[model samples]
Target: MSRKLLIDIHTHLYLPRYAQLLRARSQIPRITTLNGEERLVILAGEAATGRPVGPSYWDRDAKLRFMDTHGIAISIVSPANPWLDFLPPAPALQTCEALNSDLEEYCATSPEVELGGRRRKRLYGMGYLPVVPGQEVGGVCAAVEALGKLPHIKGVILGTQGLGKGLDDPALLPMWESIAKAGLVVFLHPHYGMPPEVWGAQENGHVLPLALGFPFETTTAVARLILTGILDKLPALKLLLAHSGGALPVLSSRLASCIAHDPVAASRLAHDARYYLGRMWYDAVAYGPEELAFVVPTRGTDRLLCGTDHPFFPPLKGEEMWMSVTENLDAVENAPGWSEGEKEGVRGGNAVELFGL
Candidate 1:
């Protein structure tokens, strides 16, 4: 039997150059040495207990090893969160270029990477663009153009906060146009999920913030994009939303209903909110059969792509295969009423088409 191509659209890595930059910084989003090992601390809230650092983050061998062990055939990796968002324009530009180049090289040089037993181009990348403060639409456009030129960069991963303001910023329209012109997929990912106040005084843990906040942030951003008519303006722009397009597939109808009820919002877009929802791709990072089932009907199997947020939500035991990956794979296979061929599409086939893999 032929092995089905299993592509992970959501794996993350800290490119060596990018990780170096992070290590040099002294603030949140910086790497610090602890007990003879490096740990990456992104959010200020999580600074006290930073994520464990190892080769799984910046080393290509480690990434390939995990992919091999987990049966992942191809991984379109992007930088981890808070990517180049804190740097100044000049530094950010240099950093973005270096990181993009490094990411491309990492993939291009890995075509011979042996997965399980055979050689394959198992590692690919989504490039980073420096759209921090002071980087205007023109700079962003240039960055987007430069990013698209990278041979292995299938797309550009963007945070919810684009150029300080949200993605619905009018200032980003030109950048959007440029990206559309390049025919690059924009992976809309969430970073700063929500305000601390939203978690309430009783909540001191990250469970509420990461679980509820991240998806909420993505849902709000995509909803705003649809309602603000960005989707209408850039109808051709390909958007891939992380975390199963957040809670969008389930909440699309309610968002559409709100748009219909609100006079201003209703007139802003040419189509209902759910119509634009169909125009995008969603990652199968919801982590369950039921969640995948809910998302499948809403986005359709073709638009659903598999992903494992590797190295971050990896298995706690060092030797164990990542539960995050297995669960997502199982979810795709077990999605209600889906045939093997249909499940295969979500598992990797859709990502192959989405990223031109």
Candidate 2:
């Protein structure tokens, strides 16, 4: 593949239907007009200081335009954070079905691009699930089966919280099995950060939650999944961790040591803790080349797919190109040990092979 065939695997959008669902809510995860501008209030204490949202959050045309500007040929889009987890089991399942249908339609009807002397869709998607607690595994499996039938929906975006418990919950084993059986990748993302008191009593904007909380949440969740031997049982499961495995690569050694010291924990896994990092996939969204380089040893070059968490970290100064996107692109380009072919793999080739794009 040419270097120009850049594929972004972590882009996001909220469908109009999902947006309307949020707008109808009277709680934290709702949209409301503040001082004549619409803001999305998803996190705790963000009701008054929610961030502004607009067409970029839902418009397909806007997404294509952004892709064109950034030289992205294809994007694997998913619904953004705080997904249907807060709703009741019935509403959550219903909402997820509707949103999944909308996402399929969104990708199926997108404009085509010329690639490899043929026309193909410029967009694909990762669907959502009603993985709430008390929701039947049968229902979730049925949803997974439905996603498998959609040509454009290649994977499912899941949060760290599984069935209202964390990923380590044995209750989610059937959920993992069904997803694996459908051959859909699980793009594990983080939404609930650490407890608020850790950041101190004073207001700190979103800096602490975004920078520290999100990644830590991912790290802990994934660690629990690994330590509890979920990956050991579900060997066929394909997990693509957001934010470059969220410090897992950096902390795997320490975790291994701790597990080694504890006989009960060490006996649970078939292999060492670090070995599972290679088994999982990661996106190059860590912003620094050094971070990407550090991750490659544990998560090999082929497992590292390029991504941009777009529509979240847009240019603050109204610049045309997003720094968040470029920073990740640059990281993959300049990652110390990567050769040209390896860089190409990280940029788009890996995603093409992983998602069968």
Candidate 3:
């Protein structure tokens, strides 16, 4: 059988308009110039501090080129991290509206440009929500409702922070309910990797944070959601966890053991831990075949989807295939006990079915 049609479900973009906004801001996570070098300072790190911001991040044409080069037939785009999370209420709401509308238009109306005599497939996007601005729950609900009306928008991409106090906050239930009602999948991506102090003084760059800290944050967020019975409460809500559920596949047994040992916590759990784990979906971003093999069976092939994390982990100097992308593809190819059909499901078919693409 032909290799499954590849879909990059986790690719990111900083739309030209959004890139302008980032450039205008003077912040640690925003773009900055030091010593005649324009750097995209997303996070403080020792490994080159962060590369300069460029067209690859914001230009729509660049995205299509990358997709074509990588043999990706479809991409589900979302705004990269630090998404409207730092803005205050009024501006945050406006920014979210503009960005969502811009993204919706880009994905829905943008014309396909031909590459190698074949036209590129149209892209799909996940809308953004202004959760940090303390927008009224009603307004937040309205935003989600609006996303459902857009043809190209299949879901909303979110960070671990819900409302203000992480995903476990009770105040987020109404928002969750609204999203569930709207049938918008929640693509839960991580931003605030552990607290900075946890990395130690000697650590100087994004390597540890991006590689290790991110997964930990995702794991913690999902754990909080599970512990609070959020999954059971919002049964219809579909969630896709980035970085393959952030180590949940391997650490789930330990989490269950911990909960089981605690009589009070275990008593409060509305359902078995595994039930919640089985309910959510994961992306195939693990770096090695063993890691993918370990995570896929635990989450089930149906729940796994492919992701490239584009515009983030670009190929290292002089490399042809990006280590980030190849590792994930290799993992899917080598996962044990899964048939080629099952592997195809994890690679792309699952996403196409789940996202209705």
Question: Model 3, poorest ten-residue lDDT window?
Answer: 112-121
Which has the higher lDDT value, candidate number 1 or candidate number 3? 1
- lDDT tens digits, residues 154-238, model 1? 8889998888888888888898899998889988898888888877788476788789889999999988778668877887899
Candidate 3, 1-357: lDDT as tens digits: 236478889899988777778779877567777678767866655225558667778888888888878787788998898787877877877888888999988897766644334665469899888888476767778788888888889999999877788888888888999999988889999988988888888945677788889999999989988888777778898999999888888888888889989888787687667778888988888877788766755468899999999887778787766776788898888887889889888777788778876
Candidate 3 lDDT score at position 22:
72
Judged by lDDT against the true structure, how good is candidate 2? 0.90
> lDDT per residue, candidate 2, 80-177, as tens digits?
98888888889988999999999999999998987667787999999999988778778888899999999999999999877777888888888899
Number of the top TM-score candidate: 2
Q: Name every residue pair that clashes in candidate 1.
A: none
By how many angstroms RMSD does model 1 differ from the true structure? 2.4
TM-score comparison, 1 vs 3, better candidate: 1
Ordered by TM-score, highest first, the candidates read 2, 1, 3
Clashing pairs in 2: none
Among these predicted structures, which one has the highest lDDT? 2
What's the TM-score of each model vs. the native? 0.95, 0.98, 0.93
Alpha carbon deviation, residue 344, candidate 2 (Å):
0.8
